[model samples]
Target: MTRYWPRFNRAGFEESVAPIDYLEWYIPRLEELRAHNLSFSGMQYNWNVLDLLGDTIADIAKPYMGDVDDPKEIIAAREGVNIENVLITNGATQGINIALLTAIAKIRNKSNGKITVAVESPTYAPIPQSALILADDVIRVNRYPPKDYGHWRINYEEWSAALKKSDILMITPISNPSGWFFHKDDLAWIIDQAKISNVTIIADEAYNDAYREIDDYCSIHSVAPNSISINSLTKVYAMGHIRFGWIVSDSETIAIARRIFMTFSGVMSSPAMRIGTKVLQQSSIVDEAIADYRSKNLPKLRSVFAKHGIVWNEPLSGVFGCFELPNGIHSELFADHYCKVNDLLVVPGTMFSDSMQNWVRVAWSIDPKSFELAVDALDRSLELALNQKQVNKSK
Candidate 1:
């Protein structure tokens, strides 16, 4: 496996250091500590947007259940895929789990044997954790940027070797933390290799909406017959509370995913489905808000990182990006110090990969004013840490 499960609990279940756990621990304390949250990777929620959708609320609030638009059909129409290729779920979290399970099932059904999985390093925790739990074997593939903080890409030789022995490949089109969108040539090459290797590809496209206009081809599931793409309203549309998400793939792959989903979650949330349908129809409202925030906050984010002499990945259009922390300052330790002393929250890169212990992920999805305050806090915190490092070195 790319990483081992931290340790087994008393119940004999494995636990890992995932972003969700840290967020769950930190969120309730955010307001108490008056912390400036730079860790929120999703778009800021807007109540006014919901207020304008009064009809949508009224329709979903009907006491009795009635006929409603199918979220699957809506997604199918939008993606130009057949209805059979779509499967709705609670959110991207569930979508990923179902996709992995479905991939395992398909492999087992074909060979009636064990399967190996290849996962990219510095990936979202759940992808590797789930693979470790479900697959017969697991291996890591390098997906990293050069020392100069250039565009991130995979080690082709390593990836090719891993794919030959792998039954499934898990990837994030717009990678988390790093915010590196796969280059067109790289993506096309991966698809071809997976086809030759008979490996199923599961793409987590949660951040892809930001680049939809520029690269609609980011949804690999729509182009590769053996691949599956998962996305949700949580990250892009600020509708995470609604718990709406979907998966796209070939009919056979989707059928397997549907069964896996059904086995765990009996049915889709009725209200979420109804609300999500309308949300998709009026996504432009949320899109406008996202664009506005990016326009104002992205520049500020770049400026703050440059001011502090941090090496940032510098993504063009995503809420989050990774940056290397000052020399000798561990990300986990610095992040905790930053939060407790400076009242700022930034995600430690160790949560995603052991190699990223000196990195952190910062998001610019909040209001410009709040983002400004958060970045200022980051500046003070960085200076304090660097100064401390200098004093220690002198000793």
Candidate 2:
């Protein structure tokens, strides 16, 4: 038997965070704190359905009992375009997997076995992992680091060239670690390039609603009808437990994706689907949740980053904000020190990709106080790291 060292950079620090343990450890403490009028470590607000929605969850769940065949009901209810354009899945992760599998099947059918995928650098880990596991050849194009730390720029020529020889292109709006979203014009150009190259585009908009302002957000589905847009109820809704997500695309793509899903996961749990339908139907509930998060927590996050002199891009939308350390400490080591000594958890940018070594992602979804405490912990950690570097240099 041989032990396999994990090649993915962030896995070790993530393991240290013990996400499952964090949930278990935090949930009970959160519940107990609720009794004392203290906030918990998640972003969802405590508003009643009546406060956010005119309809009840039960009312929303009543109409979709038959077979889940009509994608229109889900789409229309969620205010998306049409039925031919949507495929509901277990979550965004599942939608991404399905998209990759669908892309693989399409390319393999066309190329007789050779299938290649092009991805943006500093991309979400799952994109590369899925491409490696499912596609034949993978090429990664790198995005430029932001000049001001708050703004990011992508090289169009590099991205366009990569798509030319690839069968599929994977991208995320409001990238996971950087929270840097592409401009609508830039996104449009990319979509047009894909159309010309005859490549399938997979747009992961998992943080779709996390934009700083709703009007600034644009969906790639509008730009390219053929592209698959994947979204979830996790980040904005703070409903990670719901595990609901969907892919929007053309009918042919939906049919193939559904077939792949049926053969793979059979059907999503009935209860999750029921809750998901309820959640989606209440548009006001979603809006209110986003508003509450932005109004109450975003400022705290901004102030903390300011206090530490940590440079970061203000997230256009989503629970995550990316910041660069002042002293350029290795992300993994910095994050590990924060967690081990202070019980503060953060996702290292390295988890996203090697290009993100100087940055780290902080989830704004945590309680306001927890965020402040984490910032304080980070303050101490940064000083200690700087001191250690100085000592090493002196020696």
Candidate 3:
């Protein structure tokens, strides 16, 4: 047997951080709280892990031993068109990987068998990174400004031109780092172009339930019947601990994805699949989780950012909100400094894409009190970074 490091694209080089813990970087603060000490800095908030796992586990574990041929409960819960359209996996990350491999396999025999995946500029890192792993080339289309951030706006002409050359197009309905919901009209146009160009659209709707209004959000799967939709229980259900996700598309796509899954990993554990099924079937639990995020946590996050003079695209839905930092502070360095010195953590805009270097992503799905602490820490961190930069320039 030979040992080889996995080849990763540029996006792969960035380290992965749990979205919740990433914001509360201070371990000592947490320890103090555990010891029943009152803290001034406010770093102790986190998602109720027990609430997420305890409620869903029994349902998830049931399908494994039961006589059910298909997880009807989970299938109906997702509102998927049919059982054939759904393929469960470890998480949305797994769904993305499967989608890429399936796309490559389908196009491997074509003239330019090498797939070109087009992604939105300032897109989620995994989109381009996954494409690079599975395709010959990756093209990026910028949808928002890099420096002073704003809403996601697609340049239809640019997208259409790229569509001609691309074999796959990846988008997040409610984007990760941006928290910008795609306009229905833009999504419709993209679908039309994809159909004409023979490009497979992979819509990562991991944050699907995070929208402010559920009605306003449109799944790419809805517009492009052939498009592959990827979703997970992590964001919407606050069940990241369960590590369950699924892919939805036409029957053919699901079959191919299943074959690839068998070849890659003999079988997904019965446990994960069962748990996923359980979460999907429990509609009330899912709805309650969504409501908690929408009504309570989101408003608190928006006010905190506004109070600090930070602006973001008011996410119509999703767990995250993206904000731009004041001038002279690099997002990566600022994030690193904040985490290390101030016990606060945030994803640098650079992690999302090169064009997002000046931005930072804040996950608001955390406890509201913890979110407040994170916001306060962020305010102080930004001021320190700015002041330090000015002092250096004077020298």
Per-residue lDDT of 108-220 in model 3, one digit per residue for the tens? 88835567888765555556767765676778776764334545778888999899999888888776666777766777788899999999899888877545355656666
How high is the lDDT of residue 218 in model 2? 71
**True-structure lDDT of candidate 3:** 0.65
Superposed by TM-score, candidate 3 places the C-alpha of residue 321 at a distance from the truth, in angstroms, of 0.9
Q: In model 3, where do residues sit more than 4 Å from their true spots?
A: 1-73, 145-150, 298-300, 386-395
What tens digits encode model 2's per-residue C-alpha lDDT throughout 254-277? 889989989999877755676665
Comparing candidate 1 with candidate 2, which one achieves the higher lDDT?
1
Name the lDDT value of residue 382 in candidate 2.
61
Model 1, residue 92: distance off in Å is 1.0
User: Per model, how many backbone clashes are there?
Assistant: 0, 7, 10
The predictions' CA RMSDs to the true structure, in order, are: 3.6, 6.2, 6.6
Which candidate wins on lDDT?
Answer: 1
What TM-score goes with each of the models? 0.89, 0.79, 0.78
- Scored by TM-score, the top model is 1
